[model samples]
Target: MKKKLLALLLLFFIGNFLAPPVGHADQWGVITIPPGKPIKIGMGTMLTGDYASMGIDIKHGAEMAIEKKGKILGHRVILQAEDDGCAGPPSVAIAEKMCNDPLVVGLIGYMCSGGSKPASDIHNKYKVVMISASSTALELTARGIPIFFRTCWNDKIQARRAAAFALSRKWTKVVVLHDKSDYGQSLAEDFAENIRQKGGKILAMEGLTRGDKDFTPVLTKIKPLRPQLIYFGGMAAEGVLVARQMKRVGLRKTHFMSDDGCYTEKDFIQAGGKATNGCYVTYAKEPDPEWVKEFESKYGPRQTFSPQAYDAATILMMAVERVAKKQADGTLIIGKKALRDAIADTKYNGITGEIAFDPYGDRSGSVVVVYKVVEEEGKRFFKQMAF
Candidate 1:
């Protein structure tokens, strides 16, 4: 009996030693590497909605970068796309999903300010870095999340450029309209403040909701204001409606302008048709890279924000490749903090131009130029008219 008891104890000790501790096996499998598993990155953007075209454009740009690089560190790269719908709830859901993904090293987009604000909060929890292609809300940089970076310049810069252009064109009496969302409201405030400081007058400020199809009442009110310029701090989805309504309400002679919110040619020009002609937009300077021709060949013509998305993804992927630490078992161990540091220090000369970040994650050497939409050969096109 003594010998049997001793043998039983020995067996128990051997089992405990050979088997993994209680939850060890489960935990090991959680973050363990499959040597042949492809590295996955994610993109969060609008896949459905009026602004869906912009998100699709950004997606094309990211894939273009991946195609250019082929693979990162000899591992095949997979891109996972998520739809944030350019709004709050969608962004939160995507963020939570991305946080749960242990293999997703980084993210490429949250195209709008409303989406990026909440989504970034979730990313901070996992120390995952995200680079925005089109989000330009000033508060995003002010939020001070080190992991959040953007290829696009903040509205503060874009507003200054717009205000400067308006003043130069002698558009002194301006009426500002906003969509009340983070992106719209912040940009309206910035541009209005700049315009006032530079001796331009803000006659009236108005607000609009995202899905409102009617603006005749506000246009009627603003028509009497007789402002030289009607400035809209919103996307083209609503900008086109406002533009068409302005003309319908006998404000055709007035100047209609907006920030990059209406830079898209597809939605704004197509929907507004003749009304969008002569509308001014402030957009980043177009620096066509040689590879853009290649991208255009595979996917249709690049959208307004596509180039920025390309740079955002390429720089993030380059950072991932630069800092991926290899383990003894041939697994790439990408430390969250290390990847963040690499992005912060990124110096790649991307297709959009030289890419670098400020302490607040805003790109440096950014410039905005104004474009005037004109119809040529019965097709609307953006013509460069201002610096």
Candidate 2:
């Protein structure tokens, strides 16, 4: 009898160890937050690298939104920010770390599309919702990941609009360039497709490494193509280099245009100095003046996508408030699927404009604006141009 009992005890221990941990969660993926525990939101962004400015701006925006909301259902809301490195490998690691933490309810970012794409698979497996403020690659949503949502406009919309704007200006002969990143290459391809559909001539399509500074060779080759415009699909880090080297390669007469990746004044216009003058960039429409004033008062000089980040955080918190159930002992029980559904049904007016997500988790009614880099009072700034 003693030997039989020992065998039974061993079997029980093995079963318990092998089974999935559902101590604070239900079979339906409900996360239980004990009394006095704060609701944690994970933020994975580029905190260290060339794109740090954009990520820092996103962090500040989310911080402001959380501070204004104060608490959710008598529980303090906390943001756990992690540096995603704006690349694939770091993003996957961050996603794994955040998803494994039981306290982490949702996420706010994976700033670069290259990072977001791979990290998204991990988030979906854990049923963790992530809303991006800047990853604009169209394929990010095309995969039908229910947990992935973005406040940024799709690259297809921006590319089409840019092509139309270029055609309107009679800049038919153009060279398309990308930084070989998921975000940059996709945007360039879409823009090139749109240009072809609109009867514009694509002189040549080229790809470059992200961190490389020398683009004179490519520019020199393209200069002979006599393209009227060079549309670059990359961030300010490489955009500034390409713009500066164009002059050295004797492409001074070629017009330079880029996407929201190069929209910042400090990085693109200011960094490139005279090279960025008259350069055209595509970005989402500006937010409310009153809200901008309030944000600038605290954060000082907003970078791209801050407003979108604010709205993404605001929407997530609001969804959490709507779905979280408080138990008799003051514990909070939140169903992961319920929270995602609540966010999908969101229809709130945000500082950036009306907020609504489509079936594919893309923001509805997103407007892309074209701006020109110009010098005013000896300082370079982006001026909104009437398109």
Candidate 3:
């Protein structure tokens, strides 16, 4: 009798445990926050090292939006930042953390394309929605993930614009360099295609690993190529180092160009100093007339994509208010499906531009802007070019 009773007990426990977790939507990833509780929104971006300022500026932009919006469905909204250092492993860790937390309804960023590619898979596994602040890898949209969206423009049109800019400058002989990451490689390839289309010659194509401080070896090789333009498809940190080394390697007279990755003026100016002078960069857009006085009053200055980050956070907050359901006990419930739908259907005009998403989660409209690093009034900054 005792043996039979123990077997029956084992079967009972197994049946209950395997019953498929029967619960209301509140018990799922979307927690029903009671009144006075804060709704958590997660951030995945670099917060340390040479790239820390970009992510920190993005966080401040989101804070500015939250401050303006007040709250979400009567619950205070809070940002939970898990610095990923713009690398894959740390980004995955933050994605896991957000997935495990029931209150994290949506996320703001995975700033780097390499990080976003892998981290996006984890978000998909758990059905969490993420809108990126500064990731522009074309392959990300190629994946067709509904939950992934980006406020920044991708490399497609930007590459063409950059190619046109090079041709217009009569710098037909160009050397293309990339960091070998998803963002850098794709941008290089896309830009190369356009460069060829515009009848420009690619003198030499080279690849460098990210976080590589020494570019002298590569610089020595490319210097002899005598390319009219040397375009690096990488971020500001590496680009700055390369610009400084180009002078060291006797490539000082060559025109150096880069894409959005090298658009952070402050970092480039600080690191590259006079090396960045006459350097040309292309970006989707910059934050101007974007409540700059108010933003700088609180957060110092606008760096890189801070305005777009603000818009990304504001868009998420708006979606939260749109999809949140009020319960009888005064708690708010944000269902995963409803929030995703709200984001998919977004069409709000943001400070950066129109905040809309297409079927592939790409913005409906984007324009590439070019900048030239110049010194004016004893200050070095990127000056917007008309063409």
The most accurate candidate by TM-score is 2
Model 2, 241-355: lDDT tens digits are 9989998888988899999999886788778989889999999989988988999999899989889999999999999999899888888989998899999999999988998
lDDT of 3 by residue, 1-387 (tens): 999999999999999688666244532246466776788889988888878888788888887887888777678888888888887898999999998787888899998988888999999888889999889988888897878999988888778889999999899999999989888889998999899988899989999987888999999998888989988888888988988999999997899999877887567876788889999999766555748778999889678877888889888988888878887776887777778888989998787767788788888778889999999999989898989
Pick the winner on lDDT between candidates 2 and 3: 2
lDDT of 1 by residue, 1-387 (tens): 999999999999999699755332321122333577778878988888889998899888888778777777667888899988999898889888877887787898898999999999988876778999999999998988988999998999999999999999899999999999999999999999999999999999999999999999999998888999999999989999999999899998899999888998788877788888999998887766567788888997777788998888788788877777555566776667767888999887777778899999999888888899998897788888846
Give candidates' CA RMSD values in order: 6.4, 3.7, 3.7
lDDT of 3 at 359: 88
- What ranking of all candidate models by lDDT puts the best one first? 2, 1, 3
After superposition, the stretches of candidate 1 with alpha carbons farther than 4 Å from their true spots are 1-33
Best-fitting candidate, scored by lDDT: 2
Look at candidate 2 and tell me the lDDT of residue 285.
88
TM-score for candidate 3: 0.91
Q: Weakest 10 consecutive residues, lDDT, candidate 1?
A: 23-32
